[model samples]
Target: MSAAPNLVNLETVSKAYPDQVILDAVSLGVSAGQRIGVVGRNGDGKSTLLKLIARTEEPDSGRVVRTGGTTVASLGQTDTLPDASTVRSALFGDADAHEWASSPRVREVLGGLFGGLDAPSLPDGLDSRIGVLSGGERRRVDLARVLVGSADGRPASVTEGADLLLLDEPTNHLDIEGIAWLAAYLNSTKSAIVVVTHDRWFLDELCDRIWDVQGGSVFEYDGGYSAYVLARAERERQAALAEEKRQNLMRKELAWLRRGPKARTSKAKFRVDAANELIANEPPPRDAAELVSFATARLGKTVFEAHDVTVKAGDQVLLEHLDWMLGPGKRVGLVGVNGAGKTSLLRTLADATEDRRPAAGRVKVGRTVKLAWLTQHMEDLDGSWRVLESIERVAKRVQWGRKEMTAGQLAERLGFVGGRQRTLVRDLSGGQRRRLQLARLLMAEPNVLFLDEPTNDLDIETLTQLEDLLDDWPGTMIVVSHDRYFTERVADETWALLGDKRLRMLPRGIEEYLERRAEAKSDSAAPAAARAKAPSQSTIDRATQKELSKLERRLEKVEDKIAAVHADMAEFATDPGKLTELQGRLGDLERERDEIEERWMDLAD
Candidate 1:
């Protein structure tokens, strides 16, 4: 018999920098065909683990074992393509056989990867240099290389052979169609994959498991992103309960020892001594409580208005003939492809000084509208300033009444405790900087808040906290984010910028909008064969029956697990270390049950 494959196994892994420990005694196993999503806040060693597994970086002390013939590839944050390489040449090179380029299988993969972009005929030939391509185009080129694989050594027929594939935010620069295509491709691949992403919808759709790296250790959950979230919340709840019980027991033991008279029996005295020792040695829980709060100020009835507005930057039109009105407590989201001038429109609206002239239109603002803007680049902050000092300065400049509190106190409230408050702004991680910027926003107490890419690099916990804060926000808010979950939760309406300086307002959520766009695209691009083979009513009925059968089978399995919670708990009690394991499993089952039921209802409809 062939030896079993170990997709990934790390033994006694330990990695450390000079000043901090990134991972300590961390061990994890990923089996074949498993799709795992790795998540953590910035600077939590998530990327480091990926590097170790891909052999890009080595662990300080540990053994990383990969099964025989396993191939792994990682798409890192930075593009790894050469400067002068074009998309086609980057994938196949100049000397590769032309037949491979014309292959139907190759064309299919290319079409899926690039959203049906014409692969055969290029405006510029394959010899065209990559230096001229835009950022988004470059990313697509690099991704195409990976999808095509090595052409010289391996025959072009060798496709779908990736044993393991790692992607770090593959959807970073993709548009809606590109993202949909990428999702479908990943789902269809047989590769065992690990993805680190902030996109919750992508994670929910692609990953089978979640590996959360936190506090120098990894927590594994056998479910997708949503299941991981519920499991984590439940674990925190259990931990709080456990701590409370321990405290109560300690209090009771201390009271008994103090109240009892000198015991006549030696056994009673010994027991009292042991109890005191146990109480004295008990350690506090590792995690600290955070007092996170964000409240928005009230605004006037008419927040802002724009009439025949045209925004331009250096003679280039960003938005033309635009008319908009903002009301009190309105929540809006702005979305567009990269370089589509979303940021330019925002700048024109937030132009307080009127230094630059508007392009052929008028924009109006309410007299009492207090606006605060969070830019994507974070240029307003000074690198020399300490984290706490930034918050203090914002509070003082805004003339907020709560300026009496020390900088330390403010920092603590924003989840920056210990020596982190004194850390220079330049030293903070991406997530920390974002949080500090948010802290400044809270201090200003703006009636209208404009946030750009607010969820970038934020962990699930921070994202949850932000969602809660925004849910209760009283201000008229406008946000620009590609994160579907954030947009769905916070946005009441969406403004999508189409080409030619045009904007369309969509009342429905992002997912609905994407679905509609997909349908429209399909309707517009229907092939002759598809039209000819249009299904009859009977055929449609048969297809629906088949889908319903599959849905019913899935629902039945989910129901069976829901009925076996007691059995799961009994199995959980078998081992002391399995307590956490059991809790995670139970959470996964419950979430699956809910999702299956929802899907079943939809299928029935």
Candidate 2:
């Protein structure tokens, strides 16, 4: 294959603030139409690099070179729309410029964007003010604006359209469907994209190259996120092998030098001197692993129980008629689309219900169960506070003992250090703030922990560490996440918030639940297709009967397992060892029964 065209290049780039350097002598190149993902631990200057490219921030030294006159557009955490501007004006420049607003094509586009939901009437007819929109709604409007501007509309020149897009955490407020749509759109486009995100699945699916910024340097890998991981592991393995060989050679040289004067010839003396010099010059291997420890306490058998619970905000019902019983060691995952009230439900369970009361039923929390909550937005922590001071404050509030830990120490545990703790939370990177939030959450010795999108802004290593930590945690957990990999690895049960104020409990995880739901949907649609292709009534009936029989056999197998589990329970107390084995078998059987029964119900519907 021919070499790819270099679209953007950074030469000897270095950024510094006061005495600390964020990026030092970093140089990299992006080829045309290359989808590059930038990843690193929080505060590693991944965002800084993007800023330098987008010209949002200037570097202390070095230059960014673009081979082509590619117009770049960057979307940041904060929306840049004027306070009083309407959505249409913010996107299309002005009402007069947006001639497409009156066209039927525009309405069709808007309908598609909103997933065929009824478009809320623009109060002033596309001139409605934006100040009244909710934060999530504003983000959606911002995205819509970008999409329209990039397409044929006001500011319609081809040159005005973005050739390169820099998106930092674009999925921040997006739901599952929105994220999927964005991914599909990006994949279908030829725009050179540089995205800074902590979503592994997004990076894996969209990026053609990976740029890892770590320890004041950038390492470029010519592959996807998973390939980058494999490359890093292999590099570490090779380094380890080389270090071992050097150490062995040094040991042998030292042993020879320790022999008598007979071994101290000119050659022997030179070899000894070389060995000593090599040993002195050798640097220790980098200790890259992060060790995060949370002093979480264990709870009693019964953690929490809710019966016929209804949670609502004002008159809006989030979830109703729900009965949930969580044991001491259950790890539950709350999975749903955005605005599905996952956060509200979690807050209700966490007893942050002073503003909104439970409509009906009772919530009984275990006496010894202490709850720790991590909100989706880390804005709960004071932005002006230093990282260490924030952790210290949380430690004090939680009554942690007088063995005060420095911010550096806490950050080191979270895989961050090097003057980052001294930086204000406002100045800290997104990942840095996330780590600080996690550190603060860990300081609370809660047996039941609730996390809202905890995987956001986390690196693969950090994610792995979190999984290990959660695995070792003897606490009940309710994690709200859109990450399928994380949910599959960490959760034992899944709760989905379907529309119409309904919630369903799935025994399996998000992946299995989605699979079963898809299968059921296909099954439900097949009869209509069969009817359309009917040759005769008798032939159609025969085909339908065969299909029904296949389904019945599957149902019978599930019923047989349920019946077998009941029969096996009758012999649970016969013998000591045999009873223990039978009891374990019965538990497995019960879990299987629940999964099968749930799927069967969906199929029946």
Candidate 3:
């Protein structure tokens, strides 16, 4: 019956940098339990907007209001964890183990992000030094630190979650499974979430509202990324129709004015104004399709052939006696859990250049294949060079649909517009540098492309553009990405390395791979004998049994509420305000259900 109070509010907020005006005269609010996804091109102020909400950054003009004593937790794109500090110290400071160790939520966070306390990646568990961890491991630690909320050395019951969570590219370095876990965790949180990420599937699944930041303003759209895209397309269609009518009217007006001197003098001023208004209101033409015709070297029938390829990492065999072939124009997507040797396989294929090597068996490569490997490492780039300069090193000019594009134009097409082309590579953001690399790679016109974690630092816009570019590529492509949507978009076939010393093909794509992983995990979780037997209830006390029964009833009620919420959401699909409210209610119900389940598990144990 009452409106939810705002946790943070921005009133006529204006922020600008020396070179760019990021946000101008923007007004927005974040209420309790709101999940907002911020999406735009790189350097489009999405992260800046989050900072303003968290009060970590001040606006150049106007005011940002926050509720009294509201606690905020934020994860920036860059990891700020001290390399010298242990994971436990970075996460909980000097807090005792009893504080968070006893917390089920904290344990869940650890398990979801880092594969539990005893994960191989964390060889020393909480005591592992941050400096020893790889990039992905460090990223997970940074995320887990924010996600565990605040323990304060208190008991789990006394711990409190943040009122608002601001996440910038939170899904970075996260595998598909990890992303799913995070989505579930965030959905079950009572805290409001404002996340800036390029993962479209993540946005569509978790966010109730979408914020499109562009041209120094924030445009709000109801529902998820799909809804936002549809709304935008409809708006463009309506504008096109209006422009057509205006064009016809302007033509008529001009014709009448040209009839005679009398006709010109009759309503000349009115005609002139009308024509001017129409001309001023005319919209610019839309950009052409991203990918254009590029001359690719002809590929022979034998693009790449693997004969009894057995690849290994140390003693861990990744591929065992595997025979495979990559034909000309074959597009493949490689996916597996972290540490599952996807990168190893990619390198093995790329390295089979000179001979059918004895070390890893035989892999025959076609002679005409010009291979381009876009690796995750940005170290390949010379930071001192400008964006355009780096691209020009590959080629000064490229063919685009019967037209030539200078290195600068090619850079702009890849998202380095005007002044950005002049910026030093070292000064560019992670995403900018990725785009620059892609531009350079495309300039080479390689017939075969090997992309490893290509979506690492790219925005959704850039990802979409890259997909468009790849759509028309007349070459063999092998992509390894954690972003599901991008992989599905670019690759025609999906393959998985499930850590079983095999490279398996999945006809149904990622869905099938996930099912197989789920089945394997389930099978490996317990022995057949244990799974066949039920836990005895004789150990439970009368009071505990009663509590368990009550929890079961509560869970049933919660399930009903969930079903009802889903129906309400579907019914109010056209009403954004009502849909947002319903989404919040659903999240609360889900959280309640999860708490009840956890309590039940505790009681049974």
Better of 1 and 3 by TM-score: 3
**How do the residues 1-605 of candidate 3 rate in per-residue lDDT, one tens digit apiece?**
88877988999999999989999999999988888999988778999998888777899999999888667878887877889999988888788878777777787887787555433236356778999887877988878777777422221232767778889999987888788779889988888899999987788778889898987989888776655554444454457733543344333323322332241233222334534443454322212222212322367677888899887543335677888988877789999865566776776777777453524678888888888999877757777998888888989987643466688876765777678788998888877877887898888878888998888778876776566556556777899888976787677789998868788889888878878988997886577335223233357677877787667556655665565455455344447788778778878988998999899778767
Q: Of the candidates numbered 1 and 2, which has the greater TM-score value?
A: 1
lDDT of the structure predicted as candidate 1: 0.64
Name the better of 2 and 3 by TM-score.
Answer: 3
Model 3 alpha-carbon miss at residue 40, Å? 1.8
Q: Clash number for model 2?
A: 0
Instruction: Give the Å shift of residue 531 in candidate 2.
Output: 23
Among these predicted structures, which one has the highest lDDT?
3
RMSD after CA superposition, every candidate: 19.0, 16.8, 15.7
- When 2 and 3 are scored with lDDT, the better candidate is 3
lDDT of each: 0.64, 0.62, 0.73
TM-score of 2: 0.65
Better model by lDDT: candidate 1 vs candidate 3: 3
lDDT of 1 by residue, 330-363 (tens): 7788876444567777777787324344677777
